[model samples]
Target: MPHDQLPTQAHAFLRQRHNELGIPGLARRWREVRAQIRANGTWRPTYDELAYAARVAWRNSGRCIGRLRWPSLIVRDRRHITTLHDVGRELAAHLDEATNGGRIRSVITVLAPATNAGPPPVRIISPQLARYAAWPSREGVLGDPANLALTRLATDLGWSGPTRRGPFDLLPWIAATADGVLHLLPTDPMHILEVPIQHPNHPWITDLGLRWPAVPVISNMTLTFGGLWFPAPFSGTFMASEIATRNLADEHRYHQLPAIITGLRLDDRDRLRTDKALLTLHEAVLYSFEAAGVSITDHHRESRAFARFAQHEEAADRVVVGDWSWLNSYPMTPQDPSWSRYYHPGQPTPALLRDPYCLALTAGHPKPGHEPSPRQRADVPPGRCRHTQPRKGGHVSTRTPVKAHRRLTRLAAAAVTLAAVTAGLVGVSGGPAQAAGCRAAPYSAKFGAADYFMQYDGVEVISYPKYPSYYRTTSQCRDIQVRNTGDGVDFGPFYACVNFYGRSGCNYWTYVPVGQWRNLATNVKDGTKFYVWVRIDMGKYYGFRAVGDW
Candidate 1:
């Protein structure tokens, strides 16, 4: 029971337990852990300690926006169950408890932990407990593109999909147990509760035959608590945007925007048609889940709840670490309280760690090698986050270069009349010679959707970086022109700000309309340097260019 014999992580976890929960008998527990570690090289956590650690892991999960309900997580200890058949049985029970007859309770089932003297712990190889199978064909990928690797792995493991493979086919679970055997177990259809998507106003939208599972159970991540790693699968109800904007509407996924727009018989030529369609799809998901009496949350509500959670954490003297890009909702709006703020950054321990071997196994690659230790696996980087830093002037194109060129040509043609007017205004001033034709390169911008949410694509022009302030006269001012080159959509109510510093100094919100050139004049001293920034306010893809003379 010597202090030097116990690992630092175990001591740290015990100290955290005492500090956070005021758990009694800290000295006795510390002695017991030390003795256990001295005897067996690891110490087992009591059920209460294990449950608290799991809840803390959820509370510390930076990527989850619905962490406000972390305390409500139901932790089911299945450490005694090590065989594949038992693991599958427990997983089914977990699904049933999580599904909760459409109420969708947050639940986690913790299986056997890796030990020094025993066989390897039970591991679930699927990323999620209920993911659709993907099949490649001559036509194209028939199901979720994200699951292609998983489907291939399942097929290789002697798991056959439906007789007639189609979209929305449920995938079987792959589990590797302590018996050194890999097992492919099919998910019971009754355990999967799904709500059919349909719009209240648009009856024809039901023809799309889209449905989503009531609960999303993440199965691949390893839960690390009290210096022990457990294969813990957890679940929660879906955020509507996750299904509507990401899973079903992402270009790499179902890409249902075009189909929904076509179904609505909306003009594709209209710039705002895509925005309307996205809104409709989101609305449909909400309506369908609510009508079915299933639990689901929208981005707006989730954002506000996260803000409250942050407040509570701060009040309890805890730093709320988060990835801003993941916290922000897809199809981001200015109105969300969480959008304009930043959080403390760092991945805290007593958290879920992504094991590379487990990731590979889930992705259909089962290579033979020694599995990396938890310390090695914990170094995995966080996912992509939103970019807010200022970018240099260049032609940023989300589309092909040829399409960008065509848009640039059209932009030039449309700006001809405005250029002529500006030329006349410069000539009429006639005070001193000035650099009146300084133009920044055109840039493209788009709203948050799918993987594009992490990008900062906007029209930005900085004067000090390219053109010095000496190019202008004392009597003359600069007029910044922002032109939208996108397909006929009106973009803003967005801000066009002139800043002496960078984006941080941009305080003014000057609204600019898209599909045309609009001039915003900055009246400043001759030797002053400034920059103009413009970003879209609405949820639609847009292309814009900012040009100004110093």
Candidate 2:
């Protein structure tokens, strides 16, 4: 288990890939890899094979409707990067070349793989080169909801803002080493090219402050092929929906429609405002990119191109599989030919795989608080606070100021206190902390429950200036396998989210409550010390330790 000794099948797999790609020197490469496997229990692909694999991954990506142009991907061989400085330099170059001065070329830069056999390779953590800050506010998310945690992590690393975070702010690059140590990569401001959005038909649309980076460079995905993996950063020109429908129009994102509707003097009170604003926003994205001389493909045009590409693949005897939900998520779906069809999730010769969350935890996020969710009890009215009572059926309703009652009273005495306190309860409320000596200790009920198992211990809250976001684990713990059964949540095993602003700070915490959790001990034969954490939904991420039968 020291190194995944490349088997005979690996050599064949590489050879088939090379031959199918029409690359010369397939036999020589196979022999080279085979000898490396026999001698060192590893295989390092040649540059040609690496480039071919990168393109094949693009072709195999089922969710990307723009894969029709996979052959156009320009691969940069940077697999020799040793230090974080080199990564930043190479990534800047990738952005410059992919930006194409504004036209936006599709390109990918492949980097060094994980040297060790057990964990994933080092990867860039940002979803894109440019992202907004999701600061904690009484108002809704100021920037992209999807990038809230990353924004907080960037701020934690001493990256300050131009000022308070706005709807558009370029985030610095963050990458991890093979060991999972995170490093911040500073990008030269000039290298990031952003285009302001304007609508050709609606002249007033320019008043709305909306913009996006020219290139969508994804850095977190692992490129796996023939028993080898590379932390690859890939870039592509924007498809209109990526900018219009999702980035600009999605409620969690920019939520530009309300402003646009106001600017256009359209009636926003009507339910149809969202639908009308969506089309208008979609048109604005298409118009702005073109006017700015940026490269973009409208969904209708891209869908038509995809149909042709599918036919071309079929003629070559290749089954073109795709994810329908992603393909259909475009605007004016019925108008596009792609909306009419279903696709199989095709297997690629080389796949762009997502790195496991356990590997991601090596970046050193804080651990989670061992707090139980404040479940509303039947005795308490709908809006009243439900504090854990020591007795089975009885409850302690504190009408006293929450901060004052640090200790618990006897159930019979507490009932009398509750009667006196209910009048004052309208103004006073208990904070997160309560007396530990109470019949039921704070969060103890959650741990002692028969069905609830402790995943970690000694979790401490790490403070961020805006909101205390991360938790660090003091105790050692194993990774827990997680299955995201929710349709919207995209997380791996051992994911948790801590929202400081949850219900305006009452009933604020929840862990991996919905997943199918299991112990990874049997699988981790070497006892890999996995530092795991919970990335709560659109909130701060908390680290966790295993609570061993506590």
Candidate 3:
């Protein structure tokens, strides 16, 4: 590889660390990293600071400095972006005893309530707790604000199922099973939902100049909610409340809710922040957790941090058994000790940040939303790693690997040819020009249950001597296409959109477009470092392709 073919700083650090001591490397064994980088790469490697650094860099991307001065763009409600999260949270069972069967399933969840209260108003249970779950209201089950609203959420959203006779009474078959739980607790916080939900179809405006930007979730502190096992949505935009609500009432309600949950906040209109650490708001806090960037956990060593989260999660589940929905219901809300103890006015929720297993999807950690901060721009140079194809019969495969990419890229490329103009990307530009093509995973045979994982012909491109792990561009974009080359692969438009680091030589581009714009919902940019992701999903023996704005 030529000098120009070097990986981006971030990618380089990841690869180096992967090869050096391996991720989660022991302190002493990996302690020599600083010396390692000093002797080789451009800078010294930082430790115990990945999230901290990402937080710093992402926040400083010049995106957060102002009050979000972008045009108020609305993509309209699509199948994927328009989830009834608020309604789901409201309708979910906070306790396990009040349900028809009296139990919520024990599983991961994303909680996107209109506001926060004592604790998460919704409760998702695991199978163990599911057996002991309960509904929020039992007996005659009067249409209380919560149950009525929640049930409406199910019906109005057109969720597939039987009768929506109250979320607790999840009509037999509909209530049978769920991937996880959604919690909705309404607090009188100065929320924006009250504005939008109050008028979902009506056009509204925010202090951020966003007109009817229904889904502007805050990022950092926003993602922090998932640290406590909370799932929020997309961006950290503002939620509009009604005029009747009092600013004092909202603040009072904010204070009334669980400090732990309520404390999880986002950067509101008052962009007043503390640079000592990143200042974030609700959705942003949630998105921080939803962030994805190369899986931190590798095949080697052990995830000591993961073990701790598992233990805590288990203990919490045990204490939450029974029809305790009543225990923390309406007037009798109780505080959670764990969150209370760790509550700091402005501090990263390490507890949530460290544990990405249960909260990965909910928090959006290994997904979209999480972007790199500016500070992280200064990193060590990247290097080469060995690549191999899936081995057959205990030997590396002699067959050539198929090239794969997100479907939209190819579609967009075709469209570009038809349209005869490249809009956003400037073609693959950081390294020497190499013909566009796909390469096989070098270490496929090493996969234990290779069948379980999705395989693709990951394309390797060279541009101007830079080796971007993924594809990218500078133009705005005109067309993006994708191709499915597998048989009966359960893949949909899962891999379509991507995020790229803009280069004023400084900032990269990042967008959270809705699923309807393309097809897939899987984020191609989350785990990426420098290049924009041309996401693709190909099942066994099949390959995927992508071509967009190149």
Candidate 4:
């Protein structure tokens, strides 16, 4: 790679670390690295630096809620993997150690960076080593809808499936090597941990036949450090809701809720039914994982962890860039302190960046010439195939905004819980509810199911509605709010919006600061009323309007 291709500060970062950490190999490598930088302006990091970079990426992951454990990340140096088969072998070991027979550990295996300044020589097409197969059948599709395209890629790569396919069938690993040779490796059943879900309170849920892999090992992410890109596969234990709400109950996936709704005899017509089902389903995941002695974290526990992380970062004067929606996606999002505030997502630094091959496969595009495309890649499906096709594959499949909706519903439910709790609640013994003089209610209410709000004694909570994920859409329009004291006096439009759907909206207050005794309400006290106006618009796609008087 040319010297300019390397980040301008790459050498500086390495040199500073050399002087600070004083690691043995770094000084000698630093001399060689600088020589290469002078000759070609690009250099490779030593083994120790690679390990440091991997850990830094974990520490800087904004979308991940479990970042507090970044220090415990285990980085395995596998940069010498020269064969595609070896990639699979290492990945299997990754799964084995990551799962750790249910005592999961966060781990990453870093492969050699792209050499000769070319695209990655080896790439894993699968998002994770273990994912359910989405098989096409006369009756209907089986397994996770997310993996439909990759499933076809595996089959075409000479992978034979069981005669009787079930929803839990794991897909084989697919990779492309330096010589552009593609290899398919069947997933080892023993290396994968699939936990059957059973509700502690509702044992009948076991009959629903639900199970999910224990660890989420993400491959196909390019780990860039000191201006070099390493194909690193990393693993982390699943948040219970990631399995319950997304992999299982998502509309395009197992669509588990309809059955649960029927089993619980709840009315599906009402949107609240979905919320109830999600809560119960998530509960089952936590309970079952615990019963089976599998590692898992609930949303609340993770939120608390995030709070501590934020505080620690703040103490060090570090800016905590966060995707509010993602961080607040737990079943009880609104009640969490993290959701009540706003954050700036500065940048994705030292993080596990998405790979083109991974996105292509995710978009239903298989590797070119690796295997016959199940659906020819020529006819790209809008919305489904975000990237161009690698080879032939079936028609592009549509992914529902279920993942985004999952986050949205969580925030919405939290808002409802907040309102109920704020209105006043009795003690555990069922005494009469009591409240202080002040009352807080949701403001600028529109986008019914998407709107979220919370109010504590002195502070008010408001969340601008946002889209599901940036993967499917990019239009992030502004939301407006205004307040007035009856007459001509008014506070003009205050605007807020989120750039990416996967992120949270900017902050805006409909009312002004309260400390001034010459307040508008106090000044115009005689027979005067206060009014506030709020509007939300999404570029003519969706609009909401509301006005309130007090």
User: TM-score for each prediction?
Assistant: 0.66, 0.68, 0.19, 0.64
After superposition, the stretches of candidate 2 with alpha carbons farther than 4 Å from their true spots are: 1-5, 22-28, 117-122, 268-271, 358-548
Q: Candidates' lDDT values, in order?
A: 0.62, 0.54, 0.22, 0.55
TM-score of 2: 0.68
For residues 1-550, what per-residue lDDT tens digits would candidate 4 score against the true structure? 3456564557655765566466556556667776887776467676677777777677666668898888788888988886665776888899888988889999999887785455566777677877888877887788876676566555544555677888888877767655433456545677888889999788889998888888898887778767677889989878987788767876767889888888788875777887788889989999989989999998888888888888887886677766554566545446776666555544434557656434433333112232211122232223221111112232111122345333432222112111111212111111111222112122222221111121111111223222111111111111222222122112222222212222222122233221111111212222221121122222111122222111
- Deviation in angstroms for 308 in model 4? 1.0
**Cα-based lDDT at residue 2, candidate 4:** 49
Over 4 Å off, model 4: 7-9, 15-30, 37-42, 268-271, 365-550
Local accuracy of candidate 2 as per-residue lDDT tens digits, 366-462: 2122121111111222221111001122211222223212111111111110100111111111121232332222311111010011111111221
For all predictions, the C-alpha RMSD in Å is: 19.9, 15.4, 23.6, 18.3
Q: Which of candidates 2 and 4 is the stronger one according to TM-score?
A: 2
Q: Could you tell which candidate, 1 or 2, scores higher by TM-score?
A: 2
* Clashing residue pairs found in predicted model 1: none
Task: Judge candidate 3 at residue 511 and give its lDDT.
Answer: 29
lDDT by residue (209-235, candidate 1, tens digit) is 898888899887678866678888988
